[model samples]
Structures are given as C-alpha cells and as structure tokens.
Target: MNPGLYVFDFRFTEYFQMTIKPLLEEGKDGELIDWLKDISLLRRGQKCTNPDCQGTKPMEWKRARIVDKFHWSCPLCKKKVSIRTDSPLAEFHCSFKIILETIVAWCDGISLEEYTKENKNVKGVIAKRIYSTCTAATDWYMQTHPELTLLGGENSVVLVDTYPDGCMTTTPHNNNYTKRVLCVADTSHMPARIWAQLIDNKILDYQKLAAVVVGHIRPGSTVVASPSLYPLLHGVKGMAEVISVEALMALDPVDYQRSLKNLETIWRTTVSVCQDIQNTSNAEGEQMLRELEWRQVFPTPLSQILHDLAAHATAISS
Candidate 1:
C-alpha cells in the first residue's frame, strides 16, 4: 500500500526480471529477488526513527503520493522519497532499463548522443545524467576499491606513458586536439587500476605533466617515465626513474619492431582468451592471463618471458 516503497520494489523487480536475469541466466530468480527485497524499498512500517512518538504499535504501509516522475511523499512522516530511494538509480528521471543501457554504452565507450538515440530519450537529459553518473561512479569505484587506484602511494611503482590517439574536432579554436593518455600502472600489471586521463596536447610539458602525475601518484613510489617527462621530476624527491627513449631505440630496429609486433599479437590473443574465460566463468584464470598480458606491454626486461609463460599457460589451461 505504501506507494513510495512499493514503487521502488516494483521498479527493482521489473529491472531484474527484464534486464539482469536474462543477462545472468545462470543465477536463480528467487535468490536474486530475495536479495532485491532486502534493499528494494524504504517502507513506512519500518520503525519510525522518531524516538518520542510511539503512536502505532505495528507500523503499516502508508501510501505515499507520487509527485513528479520520481518524487514522492510519505503520508505518516511527510517524508519525501524518490522512486530510486536507497538505490544508486535514485534521483534519476530515466527508467532502470535506460540507466542500464547507458552504463553499458559508457563501458563500451559509446557517445552520449548515440546512447540517447538508441534509447529514444531526450538527448540533453540523458547525456547530462549519464555523464554525471559515470563520473560519480568512477570516483566511488576508485575510493571503495583501492586496487583500482592506479597511482598508489609513494611506495607504488607507477608507469607513465603517452600515445597519440585520434584527434578531436570540437575545440574552440577548431584545432585538432591530440589525445595523450596518461596511465599509471602497478608492477603487478593488474587491469589499469585507475581512470586514465586524456591529455589535450602533444608536447609533454615536464612541470605540468609532473604536477598531474605527482597529484595522483603517491610520493616515494618509483615513477617510471620516459626522458621527456624528466623535467617534471625536478624538486620531487624519492624514487623516480626516467628511462631514455634513445636507449630503448638503440636496439636493433628490426628486433625492436619484431618485439613490438609480438607484444601486440600476444595482447590481442590475451584479450580473446579473457573473453573465452569470462564466457566459461573462469574469472580467476582470466584475471591471471590479463595480468600476464599487461606485463608483456609494460617496459620491462621480463616482458618476453612473461609473454611466453602466458602463451604456455593459456595452452595448458585450455
């Protein structure tokens, strides 16, 4: 009878039945529903937090009035709640299905306009909400999961590299914005433990770059970066190793190219293996292989050995 809580549970149930269950078919429906029931609604029968008033012995579900698309009000407490109350989707005007779709699109790196069009919704609202949600989720994920934070404290080994990606066209100057991605990875080679920033310029300004890097990377952590970034390392005491590109390029050109090619091949193969592992529910094995593949791309001497090991392990595991 409590519309606020009822609507909340109903929405959750609808989402699971319509979206999640089909995707995770291996999971039991009853179990999932039970799990949902625990966090699904904010009911009035739930003991009122007010200590002084003990009017009702057994609290009842008091129907709440629905205001807008999501806003609602409880009759007893006059408390306001959204349809998404107590859930991450709370405060969102979009349906659960649209939110799920937007999340998927974001993970796949799809544009907001594309996602909005696909869901047949107002582009401005969808875009704004999706971007805000993504940024918040990213922040929350980094905070809750330390392993996902790429640049750990000073003791951490952070690797910084920049690669030229495609250009962006919508700049105020109508100039092509070169995409330089700055990534910080641990020595263990776990999936990028943090969000990578796409830098705007092609030139690597040491001071500016160092500020950004130092802000994220913990002090005293060994920062492995190219010589171009050495300027930024000034004044920053502690373990910061700048590897010279010339030194790496000094190797036989053919051999270097061969190594790069081999690395790319291994990386692609590893991604395929990961997909297969996920399909078979072998997440542990997939994680291991992903780590191995990452080590191969990282600038390290053991890269070749690790790549070989990953190939053998894949074969054996298969």
Candidate 2:
C-alpha cells in the first residue's frame, strides 16, 4: 500500500492499532518492512559498499529470517550489506516493529514501563535506545530548523517563566540545582511555540536569564515575564519590549489571559512530566523536557516524523 493513502492526522496509537497491528497479526512482516522503506525509515536506494561493486549498483532489499531481518544485495557482485549498515539505525539490533512502536510510544509520551506493559516483547534496554534515537532526532530538528527554534516576531507576545530543577551529580552525597527557562511565544492564532534551556548556573539573576531568553525571542515582540526580569529585558539591544506580568494583566486582560492560558498549559504538562523527576537525575529531567519541547514544536503525525527522520538520516546517527 502507498503510504500517501495513510496521510491523515490520526494519532500514532490509532494508526498502529488500525494498520500496523493487523499486519503483524496476519504475519505480513515483509509488507510492513516495505512500508518502512517506503517512508524512508529503513535505508532505500543505497549503493552497495562491496569493493568489487565500486558503488556502481543500487542494492536490492532482501528479506530473510536473519537477526537483522533484512539486507541489501548487489545482483552483479553477489555482495550483501545490512539494511542499517550506514543509516541512523546502525546500532539498533531490534525488529522494525519494536523500532516503530518505540517511536509511537515516544511521540505519545508513553513511559517505558507502560510501553513494555502493553508490548511485552520489547526489552527495556532496546526501548531506551529507541527513545534516545527519538531525542537525537529532536535535537537535530531544533538545531536545523531556525524558524521553529526562534520564537516571536513583530506583533507576537512571549510568556516567560523559570522552572527550578535538580541536576544529577557523580558524588553520591552531592546534588546540584538548575533553572529551566521557558519561553512560550503566543501569536493569538498559530499553535503555541516554545523554547527551553537548562541553565547551568544556580543563580537566577535577571541579567543572565534575560540574556538567554533574548537570544530565542525575536525583536519587536513583547515579553511578559515576572517583575524581577523587567530591568534586564525592558530595553536591551535587539531584545523585545518587556512587560511585567502584573502590568500586562492589568492593561490587556485578553492578551494577558491568552498568554497565561498557554503558559498554564506548558506548566501543567511539564509538571506532570517531572512529577517523579526527583528520582531521576538532572540529565534525565532535561531529556524529558527536551522531548516535550520537541513534541510542541513539531506536532506532526508519526508518518511525517518518520519521513523527516529519513530525510535527515545522515545528521541523526545512533
């Protein structure tokens, strides 16, 4: 089946339930692998790496009952290469079902335990590796997509806040704290936009926080933040005009409520993500937040995400 026919806004779970699960139930694994190749998740049209072939011939995919499940075969030279030989999936030694299911779980924000509960065949370590690959894809998206990375412009208003979090330390008795500075760009029409960073320093000085925020926000937009941030952000070079949350609340209640509404959503969602965060070290917390930020920024369906990963496969590696 052509993947284009499945281009709808259904959630990943729904798609998996309706499409992928049936394929597995019917034992049509090869067709599923073909679909993955169709979406570019598995490597496609790759040239054989055998020295005898001299990269002159395209490799054909051959399905087998091998550990990798698939390989790329050169007809002329009779050489074979693993389907994941040079792709981002090189290090992954799991089935495509596990890999795809892991992507769905990651996108749906399903915890590892929850995912394993539903799909008992998946081992925790393999699932974690897939989750890491998803994070790497998000990091690549943030680094390369400037339009999504930088928020706010001309008439936009960005709601700003800081979240206190604990970081992990190697010393068993020592602990460290960091601030997660979050900026939610509210355009009043478009879906909310977000930019987040974990400040390495413990100090939450206005100047330091403002400097970090200013870089992500565009000029001419207004920044609605707590009073402590006013002085540093109000008149900084190339920075947006700053307004205290209280003042914005009083002067323009509609916009104020709108910004607050978005901020509240972000806070509530992130707080839920960090609820059991005390058990996890700071590094893990940051990864969770980064994953959240990624979902907010892209908000694409599983197919689109797969296509994106395939398109930028070289940049995102295991």
The regions of model 1 sitting more than 4 angstroms off are 1-19, 22-87, 121-124, 143-158, 162-182, 194-224, 230-242, 255-318
Q: Which of the numbered candidates is closest to the native, going by highest TM-score? A: 2
Global lDDT of each model?
A: 0.42, 0.62
How would you encode candidate 2's per-residue C-alpha lDDT over 60-141 as one tens digit per residue?
7787678666778888887877877766566667877677767776666666666677887788888888877776676666
Winner by lDDT: 2
TM-score of 1: 0.46
The TM-score of candidate 2 is 0.73
TM-score of each: 0.46, 0.73
Report the error of model 1 at residue 298, Å: 19
Superposed by TM-score, candidate 1 places the C-alpha of residue 189 at a distance from the truth, in angstroms, of 2.3
lDDT of 1 by residue, 1-318 (tens): 111110122223444457454633443533433332344322223343445434544333333444222334444665544434444444456544454445444433345555566666545676567545543433333344444443555446555544332111111221232234454445434433433454546565657777777676666566555455545664576555444333443564753454334323323323332223333333333233333233334322122222232233233335
